[model samples]
Target: MSAESLTPTETLVLLTLLAEARPVSNTELKTLGPELRAASRRKLTRLGLVATDTSVRPFTHELTDDGWARCRTLLGADTPPRVAPPVRAVYTLLRALGRHLDRADLQLYEVFAPATEEVAPVDDTSPTVEGRIRAAYRELAREPGAWVGLARLRSALADLPVDEVDRELVRMNRLPDVHLNPEMNQKALGDHDRAAAVVVGDTPNHLLSIEVA
Candidate 1:
């Protein structure tokens, strides 16, 4: 369904998720605005606009890629019918901001990055698979956004389980700052490289890029 078809609460939920750029629980959502009730959650999930992780208590929700695209559409859409005056005003500003972003060739994620928290260094402890992947990428990449072959990357994390590493890679790829790509120069791939590839969806990604913060 289009952004115009979303209910007011649904609209708020999507926008909040977009702004937060992190999974939010119902309790946390209450502080921002309306809490996401079960019925609304089911509708959003059914529409493939939101992803709810039930593994945790109070369940946390996050926007899917489709949800992000839906919010983008709203920037150009007319305000939904019967919205409060304040919300209408917000939309007016959003449309204007959207125009500015379009002219600047900027992505919404670039403007609404998730907040980073400072933590003590983890030099004494075993690093997470995701952390190891980032560390390996940093070592191999001459600069941020430089493509590092998965074969070489995997070699650095060889002690870690291949399946576990692949799962983390797929998850990391979903983030705006991380990218996984198949080598366009297919003729250059050796057997070792092919074996090291991680399959995301139907594509085998041989290269990794992580935007260093």
Candidate 2:
């Protein structure tokens, strides 16, 4: 199927797999972020975009040819291989896929685009959870209509109890400008440094996001 035929979540999973030139374990996939859940992956597999090797305990996966073709078309790349290796790969082939594509830029175009409205300059490097939460809301909620990812919000609130942050987002939903989504989006995650923060060093299937735009 074409890019238009896939859901936003499905598209994201495919792109993540496409970023990896080698077979990535589902465990490593989880390290990418929370949106790559088993259900989303299963749906992608059913659609013939991703292949899984369940023979191992933690199954490994890669993009199928059709999946690569679709992702390349969406990415507007004419390269021979449709998928690129993770940024950590030493091989040059994977870097070629990244030649024209940036994870953030692709995320905005094919997945979720952040608001263009300029935000009031707010210092988000607060030490406390409350301060961090306040800063995160300010950072993520500058526009009247836009969406931000949970992974981003957490990065903004670094070192806080993730669950507490979740509660805070839900609490803010009562306000007119704020909304909380339990739905997970992994697009902004996994630039190598984010691996440790993934579920506090464990794979987290449940992801939550807040919108203040």
Candidate 3:
């Protein structure tokens, strides 16, 4: 569906559902406090951007593929280019962290530190790199608590140069890994520090230890 074809309400609903991949029930939609939920749903349905299934409890509602395409278009230049390493690495890290943390915490972290980069396209007219990146995140999100480390993440990002790895790490640190809370920032930095400590012992992984802005 084209963005131009969407109404204001329909656009809002589409954006919300795109950001949240899970199936939302009609009841949940009502609770969103938006008086336009019903109206928005009707518009989206007409545009073939959403589908409702009465077979499921709460009446499962999910965005169609066309819906996501329109969302990507709306996302526009704000979207980052696909970077494979971070997607793999973040998933692995989240899985490992989940073994020791709560599932809610992991989900919260994913929401805050969303993977923005899309994979580079091999040819014109092919799916944009971002689509592939989104697919990778979906794959990882499906399998919570899958263990991955820096080494494994690096392997997935074999196309990136060594300098790019450093750059990516710096960029990642600047992002809110577990939300924008100051406490979360401290914890994420602490986690990185601990990981570096293990690697460098008394020497310390100075590069990793550097504070992120």
lDDT on C-alpha atoms for all candidate structures: 0.80, 0.52, 0.43
| Candidate 1 local Cα displacement, residue 111, angstroms | 2.0
- TM-score of every prediction relative to native: 0.66, 0.34, 0.34
The whole-model C-alpha lDDT of candidate 3 against the native structure comes to 0.43
Instruction: Name the regions of candidate 3 deviating beyond 4 angstroms.
Output: 2-4, 33-39, 77-213
Per-residue lDDT tens digits of candidate 2, residues 103-123?
A: 533321222212232323335
User: Candidate 3 — which pairs collide?
Assistant: 81-117, 81-118, 82-117, 82-118, 82-119, 95-145, 118-130, 119-129
Q: Once model 1 is optimally superposed onto the true structure by TM-score, how far is the C-alpha of residue 188 displaced, in angstroms?
A: 14
Ranking by lDDT: 1, 2, 3
Q: Which lDDT tens digits does candidate 3 get at residues 1-213?
A: 544465444555665565555466767665652333566667777777787786987676766656655554443223223535543453354345445435343322234222443323334334533232223333433243232233334444446564555434433433432111222334445554434221110112222211111
In the range 1-213, model 1's lDDT, one tens digit per residue, is 443377878888888998887788988888977789888999899888889999999899988767877878777778877899978987898799899879986656556646652322434245787778888888899999999999999899889999999878866765767878888899999999999998753367799988761
Clashing residue pairs in candidate 2 (N, C-alpha, C atoms within 3 angstroms) = none
TM-score of 1: 0.66
List the candidates ranked by TM-score, beginning with the highest.
1, 2, 3
Cα lDDT, model 2, residue 54? 86
Top of the candidates by TM-score: 1
Q: What value does the lDDT take at residue 110 in candidate 3?
A: 34
